[model samples]
Target: MNKRLVVLLGMSLVSSAAFAQSSVTLYGIIDDGLTWTSNQGGKSAVQMQGSISQGNRWGLKGAEDLGGGTSAIFRLENGFNVNTGTLSQGGRLFGRLAYVGLSNDHYGTFTLGRQGEAVGDYIGALSANGTLPGGILFPHPGDLDNNGIDFRLNNAVKYVSPTIAGLTGVAMYSFGGVPGDFNKNSAKSFALQYVGGSLQLVGAYTSIDHPATAVPEGVWTPNNTVNGNYGLAASSYKVLALAAAYTIGSARFTADWTHTQFGGLDPTLGAKINGHVTFNIAELVASYMVTPTLQLGAAYSYTQGNVSATGKSPHYNEVDASVDYLLSRATDVYASATYMRAGGGAVADLAPVLSPSSSQNQLALRLGIRKRF
Candidate 1:
């Protein structure tokens, strides 16, 4: 019975049977930067962008308790690419999240397998590519509506609740285990949140089916079209979101809104017509904390799209800023800038996940650093 002594005898039988309620942890984050792309292919470069602001990861989380208050949780996250170290959401090996659940601080929580949704968890952290210096080059233009940060979901099932009096709720479903194709690459989502006091609110909804055959598993084939991968390859994809935030004293204010839909549409991948395609987005963000280690942020986003049988519309407008600082308590340092414009007169192309900008305006700048554990 080897194999590292059967994993150290199963970790000493789980540390003597939850020796004082279990817990396991190991976390990570490491970001890098040195960007400046005012047109990479068209010339104007300065690379070394790894994990934009957050993306490189590491994980293993656990919980046990299982007593009156309930507990039994698990997580396994991993997403990498700290500049060539390799692996990142499209590379699996615990591509960002993997779950197992049971939680109850008065009844709530239930999970199982790959997650993240509910508008990137209750309104994508008030937007700005889901917070923290707007990483991944700031989405919107093809983030379609993951509201907070790019994709995730695979054969799932989730629920969250508990936080009454200030509200909270969530739900999810995912599956496309394929095999007779029950809704091809299925997915679903729902969310709601509120937090009184300094005020905060959220709302969410999502849908996906055949999102390029539902990504997952090293993400690379099929392409998940709709703009970057080239439009018109949607058999379904939907999203909706609403958000709000407030705080006075060191400042904070936010607003987010989203709407996306792209059903049917497969005009062989590039169409002048064939059906459905819609998008709408709005965002406003702000952050301030002059001292206390510095901090500053700003954002503005707007997107609009349409093609319902070719009424033709394409839009863009983005703005960003950041100044972060705080080189302690987990470290950080930043500087950012982003800009986009592509108003009217567009047959399609705003990309936004980088690349694209032969002229409707595009600019980016960054100076970054990060570390966490």
Candidate 2:
């Protein structure tokens, strides 16, 4: 009996030590709002909205120590609508993000599963829609350049380098998953980011083959839940983006540019010829902290698109302004106004809900609250 008691105590100590090396956490955010739009398919509209500042999400994350400054990590995140209690991302349970990875303090991190591309991960926050002053309505026309967190890559593998001299690098690739065609639906992306004091710079590039087939539920799909049928089908899609941000006292300024191309358009897009369409977009944003709990911000952006076959150029100009007040460490309330004007025979469109306007201008306003846990 004495020997058995000693053995049981030893086993209990080992189990406790192992348990101490592993941890799991639950986290989430909720955002809801009321919105008014100047035009939607030629009519004005008002509605209750969810995910104004950010998407509503609940997630679980865990890490297990493996000694030698290395660990295994995993995450599962879900997006939902607070209004109707339905899951976002086509009703998938863990559609927002799901990944498993290994991390090393010195060697960096490697991950696999559905994940964001480099452009949206590295440079998105420096753009208008990714900033605090902007929200779903402030994304570039149709979010053609993916400056917003609108999509993710499936069957992906990603690597993030450790910060060196205030700089970090990221690379990712997605498998086509086709039985015989290895590159038919593949995607590749790369990004670099540098942070120095109050200044930061980032750049990223992404190329996808057969985007529609690669990510059927992605933003490229016609009439997606977020953007309209702006990018229905293409043989390939590519994006290049760069951004810089600087802070001075209580003020912050940001600038960014992106180039997007839809190559080898399908007949559904009305591209009668065998050429591609391209868009060049640029933006500037500034924000100031009025008080410890209050902030104000404004931004401007311009987009130019060229149709190689028709020789037609369509353009859009947009302006945005916003104010935010903090209620507590985990909650905030905000209001925003966004307007866009279209030219060259293009209709105006706002993001996340509103449809394309019949005329050349569209405006959107929203008041919302967000809480994090």
Candidate 3:
């Protein structure tokens, strides 16, 4: 009888252990906003913008406790347009993220699958563009810098080190998945960040080799010659960024600088097109909270691109401001506006209606609500 009792108790323990090893959760966010653009396609229009405050997404995340201070985790997230109920990120089911990895509190985590690049992860923290209307006006021209506007990569491997003395490091690589051209469309990036007290600092670099070829033929082509260098045969592009922020009480201030270059284009293409373009960006942002539910923020950015081809230089100055009201932990409303002016050769390439001379100006406004669950 005693033997039977021992066997039954052991079976019960095993069942409980199995149950504790696994768990799954569902999470999502829905955001929509009304936007007024001064010259979108040269026609003033009012439209609904999805994923304004945050990308509208639904995701499944799960973990299995593997014992010995380790866990197996995975995340599958999909982006969608709340305005039209269509898939975002070009219709991929898990366009935002799809990764599986092992984690331990002592070591860190290494994940494999689609993931975000270093520039998108590190420098994004210094800007408010990831939140609400900030992204609409503040994203780098064409979102070439990622910051917060661009999202994820495919076929990637990523590693994140445990924080040590307020410092952490991240690295990622994406496979091009092209036949006969192993390096084509591949990319890599790394970043290091330190957060201590009320100060934050970050530095990062990223390179992409032959990205344009990764797309289907006749779908899209790089219009800017500088981008062509990074898209064509045996070519690459690189970006370096440094950003810092300081916080005191309820107010925070941020400043950042970035330099980007494109190189290694086909010589024939380089001759017909600009071989290289060096660009610099500078930004300053400040935010304050009037109450637990109310906050105000403002930012300004300047960008200048030096032409290696010698026709003209492109420069832009933009200013942004917003006010946010938090109704609850998972819900908020905001009003925001931005004004931008382009000069030098910049306006020549803009929409004809908006660019009569080598200069252009624009204003945008948005009002929106968001909720997370």
Off by over 4 Å in 2: 1-7, 222-232, 268-273
Which candidate number has the best TM-score?
2
- Clash pairs, candidate 2, are none
Ranking by lDDT: 2, 1, 3
Assess each prediction's global lDDT (C-alpha) against the native.
0.76, 0.85, 0.72
Q: For candidate 3, report its TM-score.
A: 0.88
Q: How close is candidate 1 to the true structure, as a TM-score?
A: 0.33
For model 1, state the Cα shift of residue 144 in Å.
1.0
Question: Against the true structure, what is each candidate's TM-score?
Answer: 0.33, 0.95, 0.88
**Model 2: per-residue Cα lDDT over 1-373, one tens digit each:** 9999999999999889989999999999999988999999888999998876888999999999999999999999999999999999878899889999999999999999989898877777887787864587888887787777778888999999999999999999999988999998999999999999999999999999988878666556545311222344678999999999999999999999999988987666433445677889999999999998999999999999887766778889999999999999899999999999988767788775678877889998999999999
Residue 138, model 3: Cα distance from true site in angstroms? 1.9
Which has the higher TM-score value, candidate number 1 or candidate number 3? 3
7-110, model 3: which lDDT tens digit per residue? 99999999899788899999999878887767653566677776765778999999889888888999999999886788877788988889999998889888
Q: Tell me how far candidate 1 lies from the true structure as C-alpha RMSD in angstroms.
A: 18.9
Candidate 2 backbone clash number: 0
Count of residue pairs whose backbone atoms collide, per candidate: 0, 0, 0
